[model samples]
Target: MEFRRPGPTPTPWSYWLIRLLFKFVLKIFYGTIVVENTHLIPEDGFPCIVCANHSNSLTDALLLVTSIPSKKRKMLRLTAKSTQFGKKTFTSWLIENAGTVPIQRKRDFEGQEVDNTEVMHHLMKALEVGDAVCLFPEGFSRYHPTIAPFKTGVARLVSDVLSKNRSHSDFKISILTCSITYMHRQHFRSDVLVTFHEPMVFTPKDNPELLKPVDYNVIRDLTAQMHQQISHGTLDSPSWGLVRTSKLAARIYAPLGTRMSLGDHVRVVRTFLDAFKTVRKKRDQSLVQQEDDQHNIDPSFISELETDLKAYQDQLEKCGIKDDRIRREILPRRTIIYRMILRLTWASFLLIISMPGLLLSLPVYVVTFYAVRNFKKTGPVFDTYDEIAQYKLIYGLISGVAVWVIGVLATLPFVLITSLLIPALMWMTLRWIEDAVSSFRSFTALGRLFLIGKDTLKEMYDQRKELHGRIMDMAIALDLPANPEEYFAQAGGKQKGRVQGLWESKAKYFSIRRRRKRDWNETLRLYDKVDYPDDDSEI
Candidate 1:
């Protein structure tokens, strides 16, 4: 095979062709892809660098490419590992065609010294030609909730390019941070959020003169800013367990009947995590001051809160009940019956309409499912759980398109007609599957309400309330905002003024509710015929 060097700028035709293919693949793989702040990307042929957090391997790169609007998408050049291009494979061809810059690393090839001098020159040349280069500043992809430490490549490249070109009046460059978040990384047909933050612009006329040899402090500062921008747009939890706990706390604290978008849901989770961490820190500090012990919360209280929350979650799981349903489904018996009837009626109608599409697309579904499952057991081992979903997506698209092509060829007499009809059927099949899953969840919630009884349901609600109250207690003890949103907003600043009175009132209200609950329990005990001994006195 003859080797050809890619153009200084990306090839528009190849770039868009690959993008269109991946767009179709991603659309089917992810149930929803929410892109925020597209205006931040420079579109007027200005040199730009995009620093992004790497998580789900190719899925991250693909989603980022597809998320950008078509006007600027083709100009974006991606960076990939040098090892990817070493073999004569489809991946190498695809990356080369798409104009990916190969990055070299020493660890990738043990004992063999590696240098990125050529790679850096290629990136600088591309950016100088009025094209955007997307670099994963984390250096490599990993299944991490929080972003990894950023490499200095971004800083070095930017300073070098800008310092060299700063004499020209028209020279300019922008650095944009892209953050990607997945609702369920390994789950098929899950939702993803991609956000493009405001770019850090550098120009010839800027006051700060970064000379040929930029200071280490300057590079570190730039890296920190990039990290902060990327981290702000993601859920920066330390571990997956903390991420789960934060999400649960958000759901429990949110108002009933409130529908939050993925972006808003993420913000809510971040808020809970911030408040939780802050209060725990204060609790630790309070341990040293004996005089403050009366007012300060116990250091173990945080763990106790987490333990109780987990128990509540476990109980709900056992009962086949979701936390949101506890509030949404607690209704009068007649009202429940009415809602169930209406739900079943709508579901039946949907099922009847979707049957034809489902039947037509069954072959595509079965082939994709078995292929993915079998490949997981016998195919190349996946390093991260999220990587598996990307493979499933690619394989599913290949299978679906292959099936469509074969169908068209089989019916040669009506090739054009069959080609169009098959895709339409597949689309309808997807719509029906989504509707069916949603209806199933609703029906299950109703079933739980009927089978589990309202008394048990109310107990679950109380447990949620108790857990929420404990969180509020922690907030009050730390003199933080009672509302998680307020705490998150006022974070990293003095928070004593805004939420003090508000949290005090909230604390008093929950205290009264606790007293009422205790009184109700006492009344129930008095009504019992058998005399109960006081356990505290006997012990």
Candidate 2:
């Protein structure tokens, strides 16, 4: 038997259909235009590898393919887990029909050392012919804010492709780093950000042996930069500065102003500049002390810092006090009422969907609930209502299957209908239960919808706290002026007494330091100089 090809075919209809579906799905789900950097992709024929951070479910891959301009999107083939096609006829049909390439999950097969040599050979052949392949270098989804460490498979594939096609000097093999961010994964009408970084071009003289190790570094650096871009929405220095300044301004001015004017703008700008200077000075001091605390700090500290920084930036954007008076008079009441209504609507929808499932599977539901309750009493595996529902469906399906089989053995004609109807009903009921629970939890005042708004505010507070801590620690380490405002005052030689007093009051209320004992100017200068080191330099 011939196996299906694991890539997109040259069928125009398939390409258009996929694109149309993607546009529809993304619009409905994300609520905003699918912004992309198609210009970064090569216009001419070139062998390329598109590597994206996997955050969403299968939606990540679909977004990549459909978002790309038609010409280039047609030739793209995505490698998926081979097991997706195993023993599931309908799923297999979808995969094969969509022109997906199925990659074996296991390296070893049937007591034999499966080298994947043929797979690489076939992939290289496609690359040589100017086709693009998409891969998730992160291997699996963590659903966390940061990208995971990349797998070595991509490195190996690139190395093998380059080695085999040495004669094709014009064969341009590059890695395109893609970033995807979602406001909410399962929610309808959310926001998503997709960005494509410029490809990293490789030359023939570049060491293949070093490729894997160096590739890891390249990808990590690229991802870090991309992550920052996705979070802040720009990579240009001036734009980044503006973003930082805007955030700082929002936090300082939101409670003070109701509208923007020349005076308000100046005030916000000055506040931002002061905060940026303070943050920079503190960062410098921390680097000096990093040596001493290197052993004590966790290896994941940088990742955590990045995540915190992003959160702070997000809060700043959201808190831009367009008009302080208007916000005070209007926002609070409107926001609270809106949230309450949203919660109720969500709860009602959940209850509507779940009631039928519960009624239909009453027996199975009762048994599973008691079993889960007993199990949790022992340890607590199924802690959530969703987990309990999942268990109910599993048990229900097993029992239904047993009944269907017995019915089939007793009467062959009824077997077919029983097998089909039993599983279908169980599946539908399980889905209904899940949706209902989710809706109820989301819409009820006690559920996520109500808490999410509060959580967002709390997150903003936490981010500020983290930023303040980092600044203080850096200041103490660098021996800078203990107070951030003092450092600013001294550097700028302008001691606006009122400005200092205002900052002092805010810091005191927030539990942030009023003074430190370090000078971080030199450290900040040093960090700026070395932040983007030469590509040849060791990380």
Candidate 3:
């Protein structure tokens, strides 16, 4: 009688315990996990390949595994480097207990080269038994904004699986494209966007021989699509205030708050996508007007449009949204619910975090104002380094004074109980100042350089607003809508009516607005008035 090793057990209790632990840790970390298209996962036992772009840090696998629904969870396994298992007992336990298959990357194992053949065999065996295997085609994590080229292992594995079961060739291996995105990966309370593209069929025709040469192209196209969907889907339909608020939350309050719920994460992503689309639309409209004015559209216009179109195309491909039926059914519903939930959750979280900071920072805020004023005036007397050092000095002084004042106020009978509040306030005030200065310097060095006096800049901004108001009045008098929003909308609507005349109305709208602003400036002699001080000094 021959003895054979039994197949990997379901480990129901282990999986449930792991999941419970995952929930507890997520709560503790305040981590948010968003999973898109959970329905795509087959409920019945089916062989499937889970391929995701790796971009997050090491804990990405944890995030992915934990977010998977419980029913299908035990059937999943990951491919990990053998070296990780060799060095650490804990890592080895994690790999084995988590059902990870170890593969050597560079060295030979037991007289065989570190080729993926054995790994592919193990994966295929697992698949034959209806297991879901997770693999990062890129092999490792990479930076955002671009995806690395995919290794050929995935293509090879699919090819082998099809070849082994010729009659069952229609065995239907579902290839799922997954993407995990982060606001700031290492930071606590950061939002994650997990998007799932519909399952793709890896028919025999999509074999290694045919695909190897063009595999990169296929992966690139797919990965780009995933990035755009995950990236833009997160941003769709957010108000400007909400967008700004979310960004602020990610930076400050995000660190302090608990991890966002899956629903909240989806909402943040949708808000971002909506904002991106709005900005892109505005940009396109402006470019169209510029092209019509020049009487010849620039080649660069087409290039930019092509880029944006490609992004959208790629996104569609990954989400398997290319199926018109699925898109029509899923997208609208998901978008509406996601937006509502995000707005409420985000607003609540921001209010909770910011309220205490606001109340506590009040007294220290007075000191911060004085420090800012002094820092602005002292810039002319110091170079960049000197100015920064002096600014730090002023900050320390203010913080010290605020601390002392808070301590004294706490000593009062009613205030003593409240004195604990002062420490938090002081901390928040200093942090806000640091963040503001850092952001200000990054956005414009001139902000720091010209910090000699900001009153002049304030006056200039007021003058510009006045000029813009006068231009709007002129536009209304010229029979255009008084509001830019109404003017653009009407123009767009009219342009849509005439396919051949698309963009002509938008061109005319902007031309009228631009000409009006110019006329208003001339009428007010604004430039001449502002130039006088400089001219007088030269004279």
Candidate 4:
């Protein structure tokens, strides 16, 4: 089915303002937000139902609203819980104006009669106007690596629309499925990938009787199809442990000395997971396939790879080293020293200029930091890791705005100048902090060069190289692409890294790594045991 590419659509000033704020917040929150296949979003089509797997709470919706690029920004009428409405707060006002469609759930309002017929009408009205309507088919947000069971809301919407418009000769609608993947959800400044998959078209005008009633079976089947489409764009593993292991394997499998974009990282991880699933399925079912088959994989090879990876991880932890540090291009002692000095010098200069702003911004920064830090202690218990970031975002925004307003009023005589200068200073202060942290890490890594014995460093290097070469060989034997970065780049994906020259490589090596600084407790929390099977679990 062909979908007409969406052109500029008229959007309200309020929606655009909100979207602008969302874009700014997302940019600050995530180090990089890469959007892929934006062409698949039918922004100007007949009743478009956009569905996404709700994995990261409000952040998922915000990404959908702001990440995708379009010639004309189309306001996505989000379907939110009815409980979210009927409030006099800022959130309610924001959602109300942002074109949110509220659906009533009986569980939310106990002993009170709730109806969604009106909600359905509101959604239908919005769609009939050629507006894109987005809803999380999974119903609620989750931190699980896999998609949740769909709530049938999406299926019912599609079926109802198609059924209602069956008589119109030119009637049609498109369902755009999206998937959001986060490298590290709880941490700030991590990478996020938003993938918009091809749209599925439903044309009841050609065959009126082809439309089915929105019954249990029909909704279930449609939801399953939607789930499959969204799943295609996600990295689904049995548990977080498998996810981490797969990422580790991907890092080792990737070409040495090459930095991968998060998109490539996720794709490579999926490649490993796909191989694991295939090998495990064959082993569990006792399937006998010819060795010449392209899909055929050796179970022993995969087992050995996993075992070696675990050992490599243990070794790195024991050595207090990171995989990136080991695989990074080695530089001479003088070059390292110069680079360290340069970074430290730049950091010191930045800190001097940023001190005044940092002090002025200190109250807001410290309050937001400590508030979010002690949130779980004083606030309600968080259910998922995803909630942490969302809370931080909300707290930061509210506190920042509130504090800025108060500061401006207190210094009314210089309101105009201070208001403009304060925000810029705050921004400068944030950049300085990031640079300071990066410089500190570079300094530490450089200092370690002088402290570590040459023999021990060489041994660690040799072990890592051996493991990396073995993974490369196994990947080749399995007929996986040798260079994933190039493969993705060839497919029109953009990656950020230094080019192939000695000086350029050194510059890229010193570039700030976006990896989260994990303490011992954070590490333990991440690798906590989950009692799930190794096999792929159904969504």
Candidate 1 segments whose C-alpha is farther than 4 A from its true place: 1-10, 86-90, 204-209, 255-258, 277-304, 329-356, 374-382, 469-539
Give TM-scores for every candidate, taking all chains together and pairing residue i with residue i: 0.78, 0.46, 0.45, 0.81
Displacement of residue 173 (Cα, Å) in model 2 is 1.5
lDDT of 2 by residue, 1-539 (tens): 22222443355466466557555445533433334568888643567778877655356776787667766556567776666665654335445655667666553246655455776677777666666788876665433333456666765677666666555444457777776654333332333556677777664455444343345675455555544433333212222343343333333323322112212223333334333443444455664234234224332343344345555544443443111112222235456567657756764665576565455456654665576566446632212221332233334444444554664576667877766665455445544443344333323323332334555555555545556566445334444345544334344222121224566645543221111101110010111111121222211
lDDT string, candidate 3, 1-539, tens digits: 22222344365565455446544444323223446677777543667777776654235566667767767546567777676675544435555667678877653356665666677788888876667788877665543223455666665666567666544434656677776655434332334556676776665445434233344565545555544543443432223333332332221111111122333333433432333344445465674333322223333443343343334333323422121211122224345445545544544454455566656555544665565566556533112212222233234344555665767675787686556556555444433332333233222322222332344334433533443454334233334344433333243222121122347534643221111111000111111111111212211
Tens-place lDDT digits, model 1, residues 328-438:
647777876777777777767767777877766666678767866775676333234436666666667667778888889899999989899888866765655554555
Of candidate 1, the 10-residue stretch with the lowest lDDT total is: 512-521
lDDT for 298 (candidate 4): 62
- For candidate 2, the per-residue lDDT at 421 reads 62
TM-score of 3: 0.45
Error of 2 at 55 (Å): 2.4
Report, for every candidate in turn, its global Cα lDDT versus the true structure.
0.66, 0.47, 0.46, 0.67
Error of 4 at 265 (Å): 2.6
lDDT of 2 at 72: 58
Question: How many angstroms is residue 269 displaced in model 2 relative to the true structure, after the best TM-score fit?
Answer: 20
User: Which 10-residue window in model 2 sums to the lowest lDDT?
Assistant: 521-530
lDDT of 2: 0.47
**CA RMSD, predictions in order:** 12.7, 17.1, 19.7, 5.8
Ranking by lDDT: 4, 1, 2, 3
* Candidate 2 vs candidate 3, lDDT winner: 2
